[model samples]
Target: MASEANPRQGRPSMTSAMRSSSFIKEHQQYRPPSKPENHYGIDTVVEDLQASKISSPRQISPFNGVPSAENPPTIVESGVSHELSHPNCTSAPGTKYDKLVATLFYKSTSPRVSNTVHSPVRVPSPTRGQSPKPHPSDSEFPPNMSPSSSIDTFPLEPPASEPEPLDHLYGSHISPMCITSFLHLMSTFPLPPGTADLNSAHRCLKLDATHDYHPTVVELTMSPAPSLDYLSLEDLRKHELIYRFEREWNTDVVLRSDTLWRRYPRLVVFDMDSTLITQEVIDLLAATIQDPPDLGARVADITHRAMLGELEFDGAFRERVKLLKGLPASIFTELRPVLDVTNGVVPLLRALKKLGVKTAVLSGGFLPLTSWLSGELGLDYSHANEVVIDETTGRLTGEVKGRIVGKERKRELLIEIAEKEGIALEQVVAVGDGANDLLMMDAAGLGVAWNAKPRVQMEAGARLNGDSLLDLLYLFGFSDEDIQTLIA
Candidate 1:
């Protein structure tokens, strides 16, 4: 009876333990085996599982259909392994087992996987008979790294771009040596107000090369304010800034209008005496008188004063001519050959002629000298005061026949010539040095003072302090190459 009681009491205890162990084993049997930590994801794990089954099939238990394992089963969390023995599988809480499995799945299959514990993970059920797509190896991770290793993704960003400078450009006249300093000056130089929109796409256009101290045109695309015109802007530059720049830098900054008429003048009128020729013809004639040895000096002084507007041109001119009384007409023939034409006048005229532009010399000097000069220069027109000569003695009679080609006459002549040529006044360019040339300059579209007196330089439309008159081509927007082509 004692043996029976012991067997009966132990039977209930053994039965309860077996039931609990069997339930836990049955639950784990149907669940898929966890993949090795280094595997890519659930897809890779499943494929490997199928491959393993075909290679070495596990024998299933007849009682509960559970596959027999050769080694102990393991739990994986972020490549770390923990063995789950048969005793622990049954003894541990079901929820705890579920939590570990969830974390492993999340680390492997989550889009943005983390290595933290207890994170929920979901393993997707792939379609039946569908071939799993392989994960791209190159883009996702480095070639040296294994696909199963944890990826520390850091999204790449592009670098920022820098803004280009506005006044970093220059013309062909600027030399390579001075480009650095020139760029610095231009960068800091204050541009004309209301002439540029600071916020707009304002930039200087480099038309040609650069030189240290040569004529350079800084081309800028202007967006002037509504109230201002190009003429006004030009005047502003002339009055306010031109002299200062010229005094300091020896650079004549000519801000010209971008007009076809200004760029290409149909008629170019020149002043005689100190302009086309080096010596003033009257002063040269006064030098020939033997009776008055100081007549030449006196005439030159009067000429200088008349040119500066200090003396009345008509009175001063007649006074100088009176001093040349009894001068032989043969002086013209003798002096014509010795006349020195101003520098760059020949090439300038030749270039103008090639472009089919009409050129004229309207002079305050004698008609003979003007006509001689016009013919020598291949000029289209010539007008000047005709000196009365005695046929009997072949000498000057101290009298001018026609109206003196003074300041007003020069302006009138310019207008008349423009009208005769069917050219507008705005298409005529006049170049001279004396104050008498100012009226003519004012009448024309563009007037350039060529190494003139201070008063003339201040009032004329533009001034050239440089050596060559050929540099005037640059002011007209002609590049060095263009001038070469035209001159050639």
Candidate 2:
């Protein structure tokens, strides 16, 4: 009875053992083995495991369905008996692994392989005692690396050790092939240091070195020469000659000195009609004549022709004076007060006098007009044709005294004035409008064709296109600031 009671007491213990075994078996079916301890000899495998953890996909391994010898997959030592035991377990023939191993062996003499079941293995370094270093061209890594990535990795190892030397020689950082290529390039081109060739090569590389490197490339390619038609010797010489001529012509026309106006001329000779006074004296005189204004038009036509050198001065003067045969000389006295001077004449003449220049009026009109102008303007001298009137009748005299003061006469007078004043010919300045004035203009040092005829404009040295006569002060080296005080 006591023995039967003891059996009952042990029943619970037996039941507990059975339940624990069942639980342990179920856990083993699902759970991975615990990580192994790293002994000194086992450190390489542990390191590989750490490396694999870093490289492996985040999730469980895809080949986990294959059973492994160890409870948890472990890195197997390469060339060990256990490694060959799984020879059939390796990737089949013609697989990516086979190709990879073949490429490694071809590139390296004694390529190492890792036997880790689940860890990624780095293909080993080239054999320790190899003959020649494997060319990167022969490596499978280059083919496997994407074109963009390969290009990025080019210049893997420059032939030279330092970057600065390459920069000094080539003006840019060195390329992987640069040191090897430099000697060859120098041999081919053989340019002197610091020459344009060296500079050009450096500049070309600086601009184009960013390009992708090709494995097959043996040398750097130079850009093609521009398709320009170079000038021949004759063409170049002709162009140079033409350029020189044009430059000289341009220089001649430009102002000799910027301060031309400050150094005013010693003498300033002005044209009377239309230049000094607002209206033409002949035209004014013609307006005073009778017989229906037609005679006035005819006289004006004759005056224009004479002034323009189209008609002889003596002939035009005699013809016009003949038409005025019956007119009284008192007309001049009446016209004197009404004769209009230009806007800036009085001030300009005052400024000229202040500067010690001899100012004179040389006109083709009669003394009746010019005499009044000279007295009114306080001119130093005046020249003009004299009108002859019958002393007794005070009317019908058809003669002009002395030679007609036309173009040639104007030139003669300019010369005479320069000589009389004891001034150099270069010191004289002539200003006028008519074609007749061209002769005087040519004779004088500085000829200003003031609002001149086309013929005069073509012949004169300079023209006064502006409205104010004060601008002539600019030609005499007067500054705008100086003129302000003078004007005031």
Candidate 3:
């Protein structure tokens, strides 16, 4: 009767019968415990009933309160697929919740349960392709070392949220507020302390203080130590001058005492005619004669020519003296008080004497005049051609007794002084203003042309254009202080 109930119904029923086999078997194998009757709402039953109408071959549910076979509720996996298809059914495999549970339970705790859990197999992370980047603080250390040690071994503390007071960091103690205040003070009023001198508290502050905010600590160990004593004004002046000249000339040539005295001369030879004395002694002598103009010019020309090295010393001397054959010897006595010394000669001679340097008068002019100056200035020596005058007649015979002291004799005299004094040739200094003095100037170690002739200036080692002979002290490394002592 059941098989023959409806042949058309049997066809649909057969397919339903096959599909329901697994569900029915599962239900029978694991029978669900009884639930309360009110658990299944009427609306839920109606919904199941309608679904059965749409689907073929539905049957009665065994338990009314339980979920129907055709319309079971979905149970979504937590943190996995959130879509709800059926309330009573579990979520699909490979969901996020399944992975999380697998990680916490199976992978992490399996070691305790099994001794050979194969090292608790790791699930290759989805983020495995990218390497982890280091933190900013870790950059200080090598890659092989742990970053923790670097943080532990850092010399300075980390920047604080609230800065400390200035006094706390520098004056006395350490605190965040102190450090901040100190940094503020440094930034506002920064000064270099390293340049300060030792023993001076201000200098010590400058040396030890770090006014720079960026790097708070100053290293004073490398700074130079200050001298115990300061230099005097005179020494300071000399140092300054030396520094200036050295910079200007780009040379280390210093004005040293030993160099000056050694390089300069001991004997300064002077020519007495137009050089030492203002007027030409020969012209003055010629004035005493009757034919003053003719004889004076002639003698002047001879003196001039001989001084310029144009004529031989003896020849010029003989020629000039011959013209004065009738001149009175008393003319020298008359002109003795009238002769004038050059502007700077007196002071120069005095200074030279004080310096222990010798002065010599070498002249083609008469000895009478040279001898007077020699005695007045305390000159070491004097050489000149003598005018032979008849004592009773008080007249000149016009003959020079010795060799005329001209350019050759001037040079000869300079050499004689150097040889006689046992001084080095470099220790002889010759000063003259005439062309005739060139040979003597060149003979000495250092030749000075004092307000010299243009020709002499070119040949001399140094030239002094000014009338003040005090400048000559410079040639010997005599500073203003030394000059004061010499003049005094």
In candidate 3, what are the lDDT values of residues 357-396, reduced to their tens digit? 8888887688887898789878999988787878889888
Q: Highest TM-score: which candidate? A: 1
Write candidate 1's Cα lDDT for 360-476 as tens digits.
999999888789889988999999999999999999999888799999999999999999999998889999999989999999988888878877887887777655677667656
> Per-candidate TM vs. native?
0.58, 0.47, 0.45
True lDDT of residue 112, candidate 2: 24
- After superposition, which runs of candidate 1 have C-alpha atoms over 4 Å from their true positions? 1-221, 225-234
The segments of candidate 2 whose C-alpha lies over 4 angstroms from its true place after superposition are 1-262
1 versus 2: better lDDT goes to = 1
Tell me which of candidates 1 and 2 scores higher on TM-score.
1
RMSD of each: 33.7, 37.7, 43.3
Question: What's the TM for model 1?
Answer: 0.58
How would the candidate models be sorted by lDDT, starting from the highest? 1, 2, 3
Alpha-carbon deviation at 383 in model 2, angstroms? 0.9
TM-score of 3: 0.45
Per-model CA lDDT versus the true structure: 0.65, 0.56, 0.54
Clash numbers, per candidate: 12, 11, 20
